[model samples]
Target: MLARVRRNGGTAEEFIGRSGPGVQARVPVVTSEGANKVQDVRFVGLDGPGWLLRGTITGTGAVPGSTDAWSCGMRLVGR
Candidate 1:
């Protein structure tokens, strides 16, 4: 998954164990012919009895190894 992102001109960081078994990527936000904009995005997945959850996060909450309230809360829930 990380390779795929990089291959397409994006950067990714993977998180594991206590923080995540997920990926955070900074990908191009433009598809046009001009200068491309890059934005950070996070992808997280969780599986429980007969159900699965996948989340995509953006904005300020997408900081890598984030220590904010929302990021902390998510880590607790994921565990």
Candidate 2:
């Protein structure tokens, strides 16, 4: 999954949060004010019998060390 991002000219770093192993990256965003911003995002995948669950963390939840990220990750990965 992360390989696909790097192949497309983006950066993907591995991280272990409450969600366990996942990929993190900084993505460019255009805000409501029409200003450019670099936002932190995370992608996590869970696999189950012939199925996959993908979750994304964006905005405040994407900030490193933020409790929001931890909580969200827990909910996503713990299930």
Candidate 3:
């Protein structure tokens, strides 16, 4: 899974175990007109449940290891 980040020229580092080793990556998203945009991405997979949650934050203030958006996501996903 980490390879997916490296393949896009981004680095993937393991989380601090707050959510069971979630993935942190800052990857580039290519635009239609031959442009590149860097995006902060995080992914957490549910063990033994075949479920995965992926999040991407863009625009200003988007960064790796940030939890604001993730918190919002969890709320949307429910408890």
lDDT of each: 0.75, 0.74, 0.61
Residue pairs clashing in model 3 are none
Candidate number achieving the greatest TM-score relative to the actual structure: 1
Write down the TM-score for model 1: 0.71
> Stretches of candidate 1 above 4 Å error?
17-19, 31-35, 75-79
How close to the true structure is residue 11 of candidate 2, measured as C-alpha lDDT?
72
Q: Which ten residues in a row are the worst by lDDT in model 3?
A: 70-79
Q: Which ten residues in a row have the lowest lDDT in candidate 2?
A: 69-78
How would you order the candidates by lDDT, starting with the best? 1, 2, 3
* Candidate 1 residue pairs in clash (backbone atoms < 3 Å): none
Q: Residues 1-79, candidate 2, lDDT per residue (tens digit)? A: 7777777556789987776778888766689999987778888777778988788878787766667746454654346
The TM-score, computed over Cα atoms with residue i paired to residue i, of candidate 2 is 0.68
Best by lDDT: 1
lDDT of 3 by residue, 1-79 (tens): 7898899798888774344546777887888898997777666544336765555435442455455644323432343
